[model samples]
Target: MRVVHLLRKYNPAEWGGTETAIQRLFEGLRQHRVTSVTYAPSIGSSIAADPLTEAGFAVKRFRACVPVWGISTERKRQLIAVGGNLMSFDLIARLLREPNVALMHTHTLGRLGGIALTSARLRRIPSVVTIHGGFLDLPESMTNNFRNAHRGGLEWGKLFGALLRSRRLLKDADAVVTCNRKEAALLKEKQTCKRIVVQPHGVPTSLYRKDHRESAREAFPSIRDQRLLLAVGRIDPVKNQRWLVEQASGIFRRHPDAMLGLAGACTDEAYGESLKRKIDELGLRQRVFLTGGLPPGDPRLIGLFQSAEVIVLPSVSETFGLVILEAWAAGTTVISSRTSGALDLIQHGENGLLFDLGAPETLHQAVDCALLHPELKSRLAATGGRVASAEYDVTVLAGRMKYLYDQLIAEKNALRNSAG
Candidate 1:
């Protein structure tokens, strides 16, 4: 089967979980002899492109302009929101003309949705969309800001109309995929789509396996004698890193030997600087280490997971926390906020620990529990690793996605034949 994976960006170096997820899916599909292609917005006129030769997939990039204001991280997001619509509509229309193109799978609901809707309607092709974020379900605090920005740009009505049309596209698609059960439930409750499938994200088990801790420690000697507490994700407001910093300050009062490593790139520069200020204010300058983004195959990342005593994901809202699986695959116990998508993966006291997002004491206590009890940590890590390998492995996830694609293709063909 030949499929087109559509998104706003495809730069793996700058991408977060969504890009990784797409890359994994493409690799998996290639293993099954399925052809895949990716489309992304180009940064400028000088489009420097590269193909995933290993996975046998091609990437097509187009140029678009972006604004510079508000949070630095959000600037890129805002540009994609503008560029994806223009590019997707044109790109999808052209791609649909190719007879071998069986299906178009789109991720996220921003500009990609508009393009998917346009392509599907014009060409009568089968399409699918995956919701990776809750942009449409923005919190009350951010709703006004989001709306005002759209209105200021004279895009509020057009974007809303496009969203309504996109919903129709989702409703009529062969299937709509989500990263977790919670997202699927939300779609159903809010009538976002008629067909929704719960397919969680997966991790590459081999890279994040258990037999790498000693080697990992050798690579990063900074935490050699300390109790390492690790958190990986873009440093953004929604991630609630400030909360973690505050809680860590209190945790240090009891366990001075403990250290928290914040990994991944800072999504918002000002916000990241603000977090640094908080660390300084609480006198946690020494205990907290902020390691900026790691390279694609950085052993330091896997090392941090393997060496850390516990991995924490404190996101206030997450569709699915892939880092939790990565930590588990590395044989590290996890402590996540109760409200996150990791809640589906973690079974408190069984696989890992869960804490209330609202209560700093709950997080502090969970971290303390992991520190004081080696036996519990070992059990959680061992059990969690096994579960992660079995359920959330990239190979397994790829197989499931391949099966879904095959089914969608067969159904599309059958419908086309029946109509003829």
Candidate 2:
């Protein structure tokens, strides 16, 4: 079967959890004789390699724009960078002309997702929407940011949104997939979709089981004998890197040899600048290392995961924490904020440590526990690794998704035959 995957934004330079999830999902889908064609917004020609193309999937780029006027060029770019509701007439036209597509799967929402769903409906095929980020489960702070982002401008695209029924993406899709169980439950309550699948993001466990500590130590000489506290995610307000930087002084004081490493691209440049200023102001310039965006499965990135004493995630609102699973597969202990994803994965002192976002002291205590107690750290990593290997492997999750795809396709064909 051939599936067309739609994305809001996809740049290798700005790789994140969503991109990695799709790449890994496609990896498993291949075994089920499923072929994929990915559609994304056009990118700059300066990019050297396309990871999706390298993974042997066909990638097509379409012209997309923010459809809002009176916003500065910089503002427009920022809006697009942080999940703007972009409109793409080219994508709709392309999907209409595309040949022999079995199903349309959208990794995004808003106008793009509506386009995919509408096109699929017209073609008499099924549509699937995967909620990579939380929609109904977003924190108030995040929702406010999104609401206030493109204010004082005319959103001329409302007409297009209305015509496409953009707001009804979940309602229109045959199946809605979410990585968090909480999100799935909320969607089930609110949406009238045929199915709501709670599909946890998966990792290739074998890629992380190697001894890559030496590679990490060689690349980051300062962390040679230091206890590494690593955080992996894009540098954004949502990721809460600023909060982590604010809490660093106490951690440094507690463990003098500890060094904090942040690995990912800077999606929000303003937030990135603020984080750097805070790091400098707090005299953590020498202590905190900002390793700009590393592509998934990079040896150095995997090495950092393997070498870390504990992986720290301080996200403000995470639907599913893919980084936690990667850390688990790497056999590293995890200390995470109590987001929905962390709550689903970690069992307090059993598999990993969970701290409250409102309580900074709890985070400090969790880090201290992981660092000060060797036996607890080993037990946590071992247990988490076992869970990742046994349950959250990409192949297993892919099989579940393939089964859902087959069911939806069969239902659509039956309905079409009856209509005929």
Candidate 3:
């Protein structure tokens, strides 16, 4: 089966959860004789000159806009930093002309998604969109943060591309896929007759076989002598790295030799700067280490996961916390905010742990619980490893997706024949 993925922006140099999830999915897809061609906008000159081979898939990047051309500095930052969600009409035209496209799968939600849906209708093919980020269940403060973070004049790209066409995408999509049940239900409320599919992101299960603790500790000298408490995600306000820093001091008070590591790229420069300032103000310069973003399959990332005592996810909104499963696959204990994603994957004291996202103090309390109890960590690690290997492996996830694709294609052919 052949499929095309329409994405808003994909820069491997500045990778995030969405990029990682798709990359892992492609691994299983290739094995199942499914080839995926990805089309996205070239945001800045940041994307590689040859995005196809560089991105490990059939990638074709269409130009969205000129860099630093006809825009203010703040607008440029918003466009470059968080991405302006500009649609490439050229890319859409090219998408409609592609040959032998059995189905279209979109991972974006704006004008780009609308283009995919429109083309699918014109071609008599089925198209589905996956909501990577959770929006329906987001709290008021987080919803405001998303809106205010990129608010500015002179962002015409945003006006014409993402904002204006968002509702149309929702109304016209053939099917809506979500990474978690809550988001699926939310889409159902929006379009009750529309098909809603729930497919959780997955991880490689092989990483759990061995801890690699000794080598991992040796590689990172900073954490060699200290107990490691790690948080993996982009440095953004939504990811809640600042709250993790605020809770770090309390953890330090208990385990004085413990060190906190923040791994992932700095997607939001303003938010990234604020995190550094907060860390210094709280006198956690030595206790907290911020490693800039690392690429997928990086050995250091594998090491960080294998060696860290506990992996924490303190997101303001997470649809399906893929990192939680990655931690479990690495044979590490897990803790996350009580988002729908976390609640779906973790059982309070069973495979993983969950804390309230609203109460900042609860993070400290959860950290305290794990620090003193070695057995809790070990039990979670072992049980989590079993669950991740059995259910969340990428290969297993690929089978489910292939079945869905077959069903969609069969239904589309039947309808076409009936109309004829």
Query: For residues 309-347, could you state the per-residue lDDT of candidate 3 as single tens digits?
Result: 899899987878889888888888998999888888888
lDDT of 1 by residue, 302-401 (tens): 8888889899889877668888888887889999987547777889999999998767788888988999999999999999889888887777788888
Higher-lDDT candidate among 2 and 3?
Answer: 2
For model 3, give the 10-residue run with minimal summed lDDT.
149-158
Q: Please name the candidate that would achieve the greatest TM-score relative to the true structure.
A: 2
State every prediction's TM-score relative to the real structure. 0.87, 0.98, 0.92
Off by over 4 Å in 3: 46-55, 65-71, 79-83, 146-166, 208-211
**TM-score (C-alpha, index-matched) for candidate 2:** 0.98
Model 3, residue 215: distance off in Å is: 5.0
On lDDT, the leading prediction is: 2
Local accuracy of candidate 2 as per-residue lDDT tens digits, 1-420 = 999999999888889999999999999999888998999999755678778999899999999999998898888888788779999988898998999999999999999999999999999899999999898898988888888877989999989999999999998899999999888888788878777888898999999988888877787877888899999999998999999989999999989999999999999888899999999999999899999998889888999999899999999988999999999999999999999989999999999999988989999999999999999999999999999999998988999999999999999999899999
lDDT of 1 at 218: 73
Provide the RMSD of all predictions against the true structure, rounded to 1 decimal.
3.5, 1.0, 2.8
Question: What is each predicted model's overall lDDT from 0 to 1?
Answer: 0.72, 0.92, 0.78
